[model samples]
Target: MRRVLAGLVAGALLALAGCTAESPKTDDGAAAPTGPPCLPAASAAASPGPAPSSAGKPLPAMAVRCFDGGRYVDVAQLGNAPTILNLWRSNCEPCRTELPAFQRFVTSAGSKVRVVGVIVMDSRPAAQSVIDDKQLTFPMLEDRDQQFSIALSQVVGRSVASALPATLFIAPGGRIVYTYQGIALDDEKIRALTAAHLGIEVAA
Candidate 1:
């Protein structure tokens, strides 16, 4: 009986050892059954897809309507004044942040350039709130139809089609001289650019 019991115990110990040995190894070579799959470091650094504006071309002409005193005004009749057309949306954070600066530029350099706001992809009420909150003195054009955006995109470059917060610097002759997109325009930059383009000194 003693011999039989001893043999049985020995067999049990061997079986347990075999089961433990079959477990997955841990980092320290200890037994661990569950872990995430490891990936090669080089594969993690692979490049992503193409960037915005990778098409390498300008946008097509887009016609837009202007909002003037609850009436729709034609874009072509926007007058002969040197104009700064600012394309903005109500929900865009950059647009909201840069609006005050644009307002200041309009206030200080009103005589030099006419700053017009084009509301793109935004409702009238939402845009009105921005105008009221920021106290924007310039006319805010209603571009809910995206016509102006399409038109201006053609003038700048095709890459501008997918970009927002674009500004077109239209000369007195109705030609676009400067175009900026995806950036907040501050007072100093606006004043300098406008003064240079309009050929007049912007009063401090």
Candidate 2:
């Protein structure tokens, strides 16, 4: 409980005073991490949203380097499942605080959704340190050029005044459902957002 609150506070700080990460080291040609940790079994048949429109906009097709495995993968390949693309930095306090919660969410999510981390505008060492300290096992990617966030702003139609710590919820078939640009540390809140936006119910 205390840990969760700490994360929330740290996330809030990061949201306001964020730091950028550097380009990750990907020259080793390492294999991509096998996959994400198991997600929670929070399945409920989707109630289905209003009138299936043909207007489900797709995420950008940029290629990002996997931070852990040192390989390049297309962003398009990541949205096959209900997905959450969290943009965080190593230097951000909230990111450090919120990562554990996200990791837990991913573990609880099992195969229900894909949660990918994007570390941008921060150095790789700092990012890795936080990941190690937090024991985060989620898949991560690098965004050294800082263009991804801008692209996200355009797609989601939200002014990413401060892009770090942003969470983009992409529904199945690659359409973005919502973009949360702040700290979200509460397990119940995260679960509720997952259930409401992605149609995957995560056990609280």
Candidate 3:
């Protein structure tokens, strides 16, 4: 009787451990992303431009690592396409709300524009969990040391490093056309902004 009880307890403990452990695979047996499986930054590289100013400008010459341990994405080199750079953090409640809207926009817009997410001042695992939970597959970069933030602030001509959920609309020439800060953006707003700033139209 004692042996059977011990065996049952051990089995229960093992089952609990199995339930509690973070699995590398999801329910469908597909390997789950340990980090944000962001797409690689655009390959078309632009020559390094002058520093950004308050007026419409290019992304500051800064390099940040892709979350998936891919190549260092040069900020200035993203001028190959019209890009939307979204800044987010895992701990921000509004970021949680707005990320899905961005995902929807990505689906609706298709290749009309480029959407990139930058996770600032957040741990890779925490950001990865959010991306997994949200099913977000946008190109993502990590600004763990806040280098991108300072560069962004310089580009926008304001101290925007600590702000969560900011969006910058950049033209193909790498000039920043608009900067949206503080508010959480939905699909309609994203579309409107894209149309207004980047001059790209999508269905209403």
- The candidate that wins on lDDT is 3
TM-scores, all models, native as reference: 0.64, 0.72, 0.75
lDDT: worst 10-residue window of model 1: 33-42
Cα error, residue 183 of model 3, in Å, equals: 2.1
- List model 2 lDDT by residue over 1-204, tens digit each: 999999999998887665343233347643333333222222233223333223346788777766665556767665556778888887778777788889889788777777788888777677778877888887777776777766767777775537468887887666777778776456777788888776678775
Candidate 1 local Cα displacement, residue 149, angstroms? 0.9
C-alpha lDDT of all candidate models, in order: 0.62, 0.69, 0.78
- Give the C-alpha miss distance for residue 42 in model 3, angstroms: 4.8
lDDT tens digits by residue: candidate 3, 160-183: 667778899987767888889877
Q: Count the backbone clashes (under 3 Å) in each candidate.
A: 7, 18, 0
lDDT for predicted candidate 2 compared with the true structure: 0.69
Task: After the best TM-score superposition of candidate 1, give how far the Cα of residue 44 lies from its true spot, in angstroms.
Answer: 62
Candidate 1 Cα lDDT to native: 0.62
